[model samples]
Target: MAGQWVEVLGGIMEGSGQILRVSTALNCLLGLLLWVQKIRAGAARHA
Candidate 1:
């Protein structure tokens, strides 16, 4: 029973870690997209 509990906890920890990594990646992607848009807008204004 203890072993089963340990396994369950381990799985939950791994799942949470994976979710955190994905969220961080998505945030970085969004930031990059925003930065690109801002640059393009600035260029357009100068032109």
Candidate 2:
């Protein structure tokens, strides 16, 4: 019974890791887009 529980726990951990990685990647992409927009706006104002 303990071995079975460990296997289930391992599967959950694997799934959670995949979800975390995907979220982190999306967050980075959004941050880059926002930064680019801000820079462009600043340049337009100066011009």
CA lDDT of every candidate: 0.33, 0.33
- For model 2, residues 13-43, the per-residue Cα lDDT tens digits are 2354554455455556544211111212222
Please list the residue runs of candidate 2 whose C-alpha ends up more than 4 Å from where it truly belongs after superposition: 1-14, 32-47
Q: How many Å off is the CA of 37 in candidate 2?
A: 30
Residue 8, candidate 2: alpha-carbon lDDT: 16
What digit string (tens of lDDT, one per residue) describes model 1 on residues 1-47?
A: 11121111222323445544554555565432211112122222343
Candidate 1 achieves a global lDDT of: 0.33
Q: How many clashing residue pairs appear in each of the predictions shown?
A: 0, 0
